[model samples]
Target: MKRFFPIVFTLLYMLAMLKPVLPVFDYVINQDYIAEYLCINKDKPEMHCDGKCYLMQMLEEQNNEKKQNLPAIDLKEYPIGFVTLINLPSETTTTTPQKNHNNYHNQYRFLTSEQHFHPPIFS
Candidate 1:
């Protein structure tokens, strides 16, 4: 009797743990019924009366209707080969050559100097 008590207690605990798992099986079995119940609508005349289909069908129908109602566009109506001309300033010829002083020796005097023997401070 003592050994049977532990076995019965373990079985009860396992069954308690399994209660939550049972709903998943029920949901799987009733999935089709739940889907059919959600899809039904009386207001829309075009939807299937059985309501077994999903909401995607109604959306597809509306999209198709909208596409059919849109005006057709013609590519030929726009002008092709349209050229725009802009007048630019005339180029002037200079007889004298210009001197560039940007690279003069004074600009680079600090970089070329030797570093001090003491450790340099970054700040």
Candidate 2:
């Protein structure tokens, strides 16, 4: 099911990208219907606009909608805030040496713990 979701999403994304072409295909296939009912220059047949005006209007409307959906920002008018950096001194620690023991079992005691078994986050 997880793999199927990506395939379906990719197909859908491709289909959405081809949305503009669908209008041209519709204009080619249904030219007669568009000219008869949807054309703006239906009265002026001398210009030879066989539903081309309707197609242009549809394309222009789509373009306008795309333009409207974009976020408007004016960076020139607004002043940006200044960034400041600070440095801090880190503390040093000294370790004391421990006495060595001859117990081999103590070394393997924490080997099975979850913290050591898990991978390091920094890596």
| Sequence-dependent TM-score of model 1 | 0.28
The digit string of per-residue lDDT tens for model 1 on 31-119 reads 56645565456456476444434434545665687699898888677766585777899999878887876865665444565755787
Q: What is the lDDT of candidate 1?
A: 0.64
For model 1, give the 10-residue run with minimal summed lDDT. 48-57
What local lDDT does model 1 show for residue 48?
48
- RMSDs, each prediction? 24.3, 17.7
Q: Give Cα-based local distance difference scores for all models.
A: 0.64, 0.87
**Segments in model 1 whose C-alpha atoms lie over 4 Å from true places:** 1-34, 38-52, 75-97, 103-123
Looking at model 2, how many pairs of residues clash?
0
